[model samples]
Target chain A: METYFSAELTDFKTLYNVLKAITFKEYATLRPMEEGLKVTIEEMKCVETSAYIPVQMFESYYVRPQEDVKFKLSLKILTETLFIYGDDGNLSLKMTYKGPGFPLCLIIKHNDENITVDCQIYTMDVDESTDFLCLADECTLNKVVVNANQFLDILTDLDNTSDDLDLFLSPNPPYFRISTTSTMGESQTDISKNSEMVLLFQCENEFQAKYSFNYIKQILKVMNFANKVSISTGETGLLGLQLLINEDAKQMYVEYYITSMFEDDR
Target chain B: MRFRALLVDNAAMKDLLSTVNSLSKLSKDCVMRIVSRKVYFIIPDEDTGPRKPLAWCELPVNFYFKEFNLDGVSQEYNEIYLCFATAMLAKSLSTVKQNAKSLKIKLTNKQTPCLTLEIELASNEGLQNRQLVHDIPVEIIARKNWNDFAEPQFNDFHVSIEMPHLKPIKNIVERMKNMSHSLIVSANNFGRLSLQIKTNMVNLSAHFTNLGIQSFAVGQDNESTVGDGSANESIVTATIDIKKFLMFLTGMQLNHCRTTCSIVHGKMVKLASEQVGALSLQCFFTELSN
Candidate 1:
């Protein structure tokens, strides 16, 4: 079988965990480039998430580049297939996509048992636009960097029923604040720019934006494993988050872009 | 009925507390039967209790209590049976594992039938000890209904094998539980055990070998309670609810215990703990709901 794109990973957990976090949707588009593999999943066409896996992350990565090898597969089934051995023994994964119409073949080898499991996940043509909303690239107005775990702890108290989550970034007192009001009552969290948890703070202008609480809640699924989060906003009230996911000292990036809701929507 | 027990030994107190804590996960309520020699925690298995099979545990009264006294309805049946919520009992003994200098458990009639647990706390100041009391209401079972709380019976099992320490399999089963509701667990007399789960999407199985196998000769009275495998090299398997199986592994609190997993071939699966001087816990999971 001629392989268009193939990558060997010594451990499956690295890829499995990253995919599991972004698995809000059934299918996600995967693009294999010279640099690495990019997996993107979009919701409602307004909110999008992309995970960048560099070539260095793989034990061996090969690509023939048959006119930009790209396909979409079920993220739910793919993540489940990665850990088929069920948390026991050492597992190595060999993933291959053979040109077009061929299923993404995953060969998982149980290192301890000397057994191998072969899975063929049917790939489909990408129907959604592969474009990722990079908020930090242009129309940027504010930025705030904080430890993801700490931020996640603060966000846990947010009432999910709250329709909108307000974000305010300023150079004044309580430089970064997140406030929400719902049936459970109003709750607000304030963090100063000088706080030790804030790694980097850049706010050229006082900016305020509101996002759907449901969309903001999606980050919590993956934020626990992320080391740090870079929060950025555009002039048009677009919010962007670049999460630095550290596992076994290896760094991976997952970017999330959320379109701010109109203030009158609430 | 009158019953009071004083537990002063810290090690025994912790053991008793651990047993109760483990039993708390098996059922909402359990029968606490008190005798002169032993204190039995019984959740009698009934046909109605199919989803969650009953658990039976025996803790020697001499090991836990410094003073053990009980008066039943008659001298012939010198035992008291009390039905209480396991969570409440576990909550009352939760502190006993930590700073319990002494624990006195007595049946009290202060406006209600309750088992008042009075625990003497060890103070860091080295001054007078502080005290904590918890009143947990219990239903005193009548003597005529005592048959309902009898010890569970494991009649016929096909293969019995000694299972490895559950701490290692805890995460493995937890993850497999997500894949399927029923996990087929099988073992043979040749020291081989396997856990397999079959679903519409995937068929996955893990095999563990070179383990000790229980001999059927050990089953003198209760044929399958101590585990029995009369056949050799023949695999006997039973399908068990994956969640309940995980519970059995997680609820084991006693340390350095040998667990025997016996399967009755599509009928039932039993996990019985064996530790000399330590309380024995037998967990039963009926076959095939999924």
Candidate 2:
């Protein structure tokens, strides 16, 4: 049990805010690998989300030889603890995990105040990851890429009482349509193929799927930090939403898989 | 009893108002004791359940106000004690803090005993002088209960050290409050202060060193001095309620005054600061036995 891991990051604000946006759950599983760290959060085994932070994001990254180095931690606590360094100024962060059953330690150095914070956060047993049907291959029936900010605007216009969201995709007329129905009446937002927001529209056949409005709204949390978002649907009604958080040298990705509700189920 | 004062300086009035506003966050009501030329606001220890620490604030009557007058209970005892809702007074002061040229505070006996504040605002556009009056009702505590508000004394402290920059401490303590209910503060006479929180899940500690140690006053014995060849080099430690400590930190965020924190091992923690000729704020936190 003599394993040691340490990593350093220069600008913590970007990484801190990105992790905070997806902290809707209490516990998240953190898997530290040689390449980087992978954090996965799930809700009721129905909606699973993961963020892949590659090694290039850290100023200095290292991992000793270890097998199955995964632990469960409270996302809420981790996010709150990181923000204590504040948003302004250049904050340098050094994180370490001594070994198995040892708490994860974070040392934050604030440049302006010449202050350092050493925080030890407890870790729990890692839960098995939820395996969702793969929709990355030819099984992806429909895929569309849109500007994240524009999609957020469309989501904000939705009626508060709407329960179901219907997404339509086509290769020709009315390239994309997102409509919601509730007692307040029906609201629909349509985007044409020639619109600037629609970056890519690839539809093998005209496909449509129905997903819970509340589940789809979760994407709004990450919309501000993401530049572009890609939405795709599988033949088995699995919706994949990928957000491009940063386009700099250290690219980050936050992806969500929401199990869609079929038309007949409603 | 008759009490009246006039404040002419806007900056002094604003500072006094903001300090009172911060004090109001600690408790809803407090006793304002007025002596001949000094004013004291005291919040005694609440004995209803667990120990609630006391707060004592003193201000010179002539510092912020230009004209002052006072009529106490009697000539021999030249002091007046009145219990007033701090929130109400702070609200009235905040409303007229900006435009008021002069503020007059008086004790009035109307439908109810009230502390009347008359704010005279600068005229806008050839209009008549504008005045706004707010009557904040208060309860005059009888002389029998006056003995309860005496200043607390904790003479024997293990370590007394000046605090570091408040901005960083405030940021860390605010987060600690969210994680745990009690905070453990430990300091050594060698200029090292540690803020820690421990629970079944996690134990977190922040160590700050190279702080200035305030010299003990003359004739005061200095025991528990670090690096003095003492057998036990244990740090002076006390666990205090995190909420109260955070409130003190929040109040310090607004003022430029320096703060000194003194801790009695496993006994109590006292925080004291004063602005020359203006006001002083002191808070006491009784240690919680583990």
Candidate 3:
């Protein structure tokens, strides 16, 4: 028999810290390809989040190029198993999978002791992932990059009772504005082009769309772990958010796709 | 049935209140027994339905109080046992924890027998002295019910070891609690401890070595009988409910004190801690049969 796959990492927590941000779903599908491993989670067909950790991010990476390895496992068990190392900076990890019927094995070594974990997760047949069309010619509306910390602060100040979040983008002054209305009052936050937090802004035309605040709040889960975030809206009311994990050469990305709630639906 | 105590040290009183508050996290009602110079808090586990764990805590009366006097029911029965609501006492103590100058505890005979905490607050500018009194009702237990709250003694322990820093162990236990309902804790005589949890999805274990082994005088007599056998290398393991074990670790308030753990193979586990002022806390966990 051939060796299925095996990979090693020097700083095991880097992968753990990113996967923890998307644990709102119990089961996540893991797809190992030539480029990297994509961990995907979908909720109620309305929102989908994925964290991509490239092969270069691992110290030692190996995989059978011809074979396709895709499996679904419990995210809670995976996260808890990785956290057993207890935030030690000098730990090493080795993960392996044998074949279709074998279990996923993780070996963590710290100091002189080693912990071996065997997870017998039942794998289900892979399902086609929902495709959120991002064609440049058909659906590009607005794109902006903002500091993750500043964006989190603005979202925290918004009234939580409000159900809808209105995003206004224009080429004129006050390039970006986020407003919400509830029975209590209406709160609006305006960000000009000159603000230090707004690193890049591009808009083809004036656009306004209302999205469910509950769906947008999912982005806040990863705000503390990310340094910068890019937000974009398309003509079909599809929202895209990309979070940059670290600024160094070995960076990872966590992306979210959210479907907006239109005015006529209310 | 007369008792009164005066606590003059603000820091020590705060520590006492905090320890009581932590104990309240485990159970809502407990029996507090006071003799001439010592006090003990005991909770007996119930045998039916869900497992109600037991706890025993002891502290020297002079450790936190400046002046203390007590007269029990009689000479033979020198101890007084009172059943009180731990939550009510914790709530009352928390209100005066920050700025109280002195605290006086007295047994009062109101409409109901009550333990009254009279707190004297510090005087502020252009304001007079402030005083706050909170009465917590209690029922004095008769001497017949005192046998249910006796000190626990463990005679047949396979291994007695001083645990490593509790912060790391606590972290591991907290994570294991999320995966399974019970946890398996095993330790050997060679200063190694391991925690394991097994479920259908995963089997996880963490090992800590190079720990300090506490040599107790009781274990010395059994040392020669097992001469060169596997008793020296065998591992003593106990499986316990994760939530109950977690509560015991967090409620002891042993952040700065030394903790020693003893395991009775397939039977029970006992943990003890002693501070500088003759204050000691002990917790026991019974094994759950597989």
Kindly report which residue stretches of model 3 are placed more than 4 angstroms away from their true locations once superposed.
A1-3, A10-17, A44-47, A83-94, A107-217, A223-241, A258-266, B6-12, B46-53, B62-68, B91-104, B118-134, B215-233
Task: Please tell me how candidate 1 rates in CAPRI terms.
Answer: incorrect
Distance (Å) between predicted and true CA of A19, model 3? 2.5
Q: Per-candidate DockQ versus the true complex?
A: 0.11, 0.52, 0.31
lDDT of 3 by residue, A11-118 (tens): 756678778878888888777777887788888876778887888888777778898787777888888878864675567777786766666677776643333333
Please give, for residues A68-143, the per-residue lDDT of candidate 1 as tens digits. 7789887776787776666675878888899788778777776765445566777888764555445558546777
Show where candidate 1 strays beyond 4 Å: A1-17, A29-37, A61-251, A255-266, B44-53, B98-101, B108-111, B116-126, B129-135, B188-192, B200-207, B215-235
The window of 10 residues in a row where model 3 chain A has the poorest summed lDDT is: A112-121
lDDT of each: 0.80, 0.80, 0.77
* Clash count, one per candidate: 0, 0, 0
Worst 10 residues of 1 chain B by lDDT: B217-226
Task: Put down candidate 3 lDDT per residue, B1-290, tens digits, no spaces.
Answer: 88888887888777778778867987888888999888887765654254333778787997888888888989777778998988888888885666789999888899999999998988878667898899999999988767777776777777788777676677678888889999887776677777788888777777777777764333443343435755445567788778888887767664567888888767788877767685677778889877
State model 2's lDDT: 0.80
| Second chain TM-score, each model | 0.88, 0.90, 0.89
> Each model's RMSD to truth, in Å?
7.8, 3.5, 5.8
Q: Candidate 2: which stretches are off by over 4 Å?
A: A1-4, A129-139, A262-266, B45-53, B95-101, B122-124, B130-132, B215-233
Instruction: Name the candidate, 1 or 3, with the larger lDDT value.
Output: 1
Per-residue lDDT for B153-230 in model 2, tens only? 777777788878777788888888878999999886567788888876667777777888774332224334445465
